[model samples]
Target: MGLSAVPSGPGGEASRTDPAPPRDVAGRGAEAARLADLVARSSRGHEDAFSELYDLTASRMYGLVLRILRSADHAAEVTQEVFVEVWRQSARYAPDKGSVLAWMSTIAHRRAVDRVRSVSSEVARDEQYAVTTVVREADHVWEDVEQKMDVERVRKGMASLTAIQREAIGLAYFGGYTQTQVASLLKLPLGTVKTRIRDGLIGLRDALGVEE
Candidate 1:
């Protein structure tokens, strides 16, 4: 699907046809294995490995970020941030936790979400603050500790979600977009978006050990 232009930050429009860097997949077999190896080597301070990883995943990651942000330039910037985090946190990645692409995609999603949060309307920002304030007012100690833990649990659980489910939840809750808006942004049917959000929430509830 073709993406429309959204206003960029200080810089002008990002080159939609930016040149792709070289990829080194000589001995790599399956896509998952290739990504895993590059991530492992990158964690061990292999610059070449890191370069290859970027070459392999950057475009796709950038595209995903662009979809969420709706700005080519900001998407490019956030995609850079995502790779920086990937280089820094690759060692912490566990194979049992998820595939390398999924891990990287999670990082991309989070960075894009953060960028969107920063650019979100003041009304939404104030609403988020009000919600936080209310939580703080009720059983301050428990809310503080449990809220942190629950948020972390949900973050972890989010990575395990199907791509559509994860994106739907991120757009609705994190992007401060309504479900209809999320559906529009994602170019998915409203019913599909609703189902993904409902199912994603249920999965997150289980992850947080909340009773159904």
Candidate 2:
């Protein structure tokens, strides 16, 4: 299970303490075993082991967070937080439950989800406060008529989009999901999702007679 480099020989070449295994055979299970060892060593207060663990997992962890949050800044912050938690809770890791990657991914995913909910809650509260504090005045009849017409135009424009384009746009813009998340939710390729959204917006713009 050791993933460390082989010791050097007298001539400074890697010593063959054991025969090399086929990469195709050793790739998947070997990585899992190495990660498990890293976690175990980290739990024993080995900084080097923890550093190796972070190097191995940080990219994947950050990618997962970015996919959920759709913000590089937030993803970087959350990735750092995830490693801190992993270092603090390393001793509590139970390898029987799952692989190290799975456990770490779970922590990263939960942290990202909590951040999304917290931001959403704060935004909602701020919006409610703004609505309550704003002065309400009766609009002129002409103003009301203009607003109604604009609403109808938007509704009709939305209706003009194809079903797939509408669904992608709805999930990305209104439901507040990233394009990658929309692709996963719809079981479509990411490029396909992007195309749908782009096409949908163009259709809406054309229908609304919007310039540029």
Pairs in clash, predicted candidate 2: none
What tens digits encode model 2's per-residue C-alpha lDDT throughout 46-153?
999999999989867976776556565666788999999999999988888887888999998888767765765324323332332232222324445544565677
Candidate number with greatest TM-score: 1
TM-scores, each model vs. reference? 0.50, 0.48
For model 2, the local distance difference test gives: 0.74
Best by lDDT: 2
lDDT of each: 0.72, 0.74
Which residue pairs collide in model 1, if any? Answer: none
lDDT of 2 at 77: 82
Candidate 1 C-alpha lDDT tens digits along 19-125 = 22112122222667889999999999999999999998886697677666766556667888899999999899998887788789888877777677674522233
Shift of residue 7 alpha carbon in model 1, Å: 54
